[model samples]
Target: DTAVSQTPKYLVTQMGNDKSIKCEQNLGHDTMYWYKQDSKKFLKIMFSYNNKELIINETVPNRFSPKSPDKAHLNLHINSLELGDSAVYFCASSLSGTQYFGPGTRLLVL
Candidate 1:
């Protein structure tokens, strides 16, 4: 089984629409992060949760939030999507010094 997984592998929505990407980890890591990769392939961490509790929140827009239902799951929800929001979103979990990433969710805002 994959260590990390995400749902809605591909999402296409309008600029003002709302969407979500679900992520789950089976590695039993305590820390999970939501990252965004732009067209330039610049990856940036948007949110971080430890044990299902948010611990690190970067300068992400207020419309973006991380919802964790359990220690093994951390989902990303975005409201009022924009064209600039079109990118590949990744979910990752880390333990010790190694990080495991999901297959990634590609989101496109028309």
Candidate 2:
């Protein structure tokens, strides 16, 4: 069983195409988040939700959106992707201060 899973470990596509990365967590946590890890390994918070309601939006572009069907799943969708959008997307959850992360989904734009 996977604690967290994100589809398409690597994605490469044209700049204008729309794409999505699915994420899920089974740790019974109430809060889940989407983060982007840049080439420097600095994890920046993009969005977060608790009980299916958004709790954080850290200056992320409107072209990027996140959806949570339930407490266990959070998915990201990007529209009209740009070359600057190329980065590693990660899903994470936290109960207190401890956070658990997914392997990450790498996106490349050409």
Candidate 3:
């Protein structure tokens, strides 16, 4: 689910490089999230981890990987970056059906 998401472009790397971002939530929430930048310049839910179960959208590419080491932290690892992967990745955590998102990390695969 998308909210009034914040998008801040920052990372720029070359193709074939691996990119990773870590997210942590201190609200005692039980779920962590990974979202992708939409072509419309918005953000959309791409992966969600809850109760040790990970739910990934089928549309997500194989180059992307999501990991949750614990309830408070989550990680998104991208391998072999492609030009198409250039976009902001939004990190979030949710509890009681409300989500709190980060400013987002912008990836540019050149």
Structural similarity to truth (TM-score) of each candidate: 0.97, 0.96, 0.85
How many pairs of residues collide in model 1?
0
Residue-wise lDDT of candidate 2 within 1-110, one digit each (tens)?
88888897999999899999999888998899999988788889999999999999999999999999999999999999999999999999878878899999999999
- For each candidate, what is the lDDT? 0.94, 0.93, 0.78
Q: Which 10-residue span in candidate 1 carries the lowest summed lDDT? A: 92-101
Candidate 1, residues 1-110, lDDT tens digits: the string is: 88899998999999999898999999989999999999999999899999989999999999998999998999998999999999999999999968899999999999
After the best TM-score superposition of candidate 1, give how far the Cα of residue 78 lies from its true spot, in angstroms. Answer: 0.4
Ranking by TM-score: 1, 2, 3
Off by over 4 Å in 2: none
Tens digits of per-residue lDDT for model 3, 1-110? 33323333488889999978777667788877888885579877889899557965557888888878888778888899998888888888888999888778888889
Instruction: Give the Å error, residue 71, model 3.
Output: 0.7
Off by over 4 Å in 3: 1-9
Candidate 3 Cα deviation (angstroms), residue 54: 0.4
lDDT of 1 at 6: 98
- How many clashes does each candidate structure show, in the order listed? 0, 0, 0
Give the winner by TM-score.
1
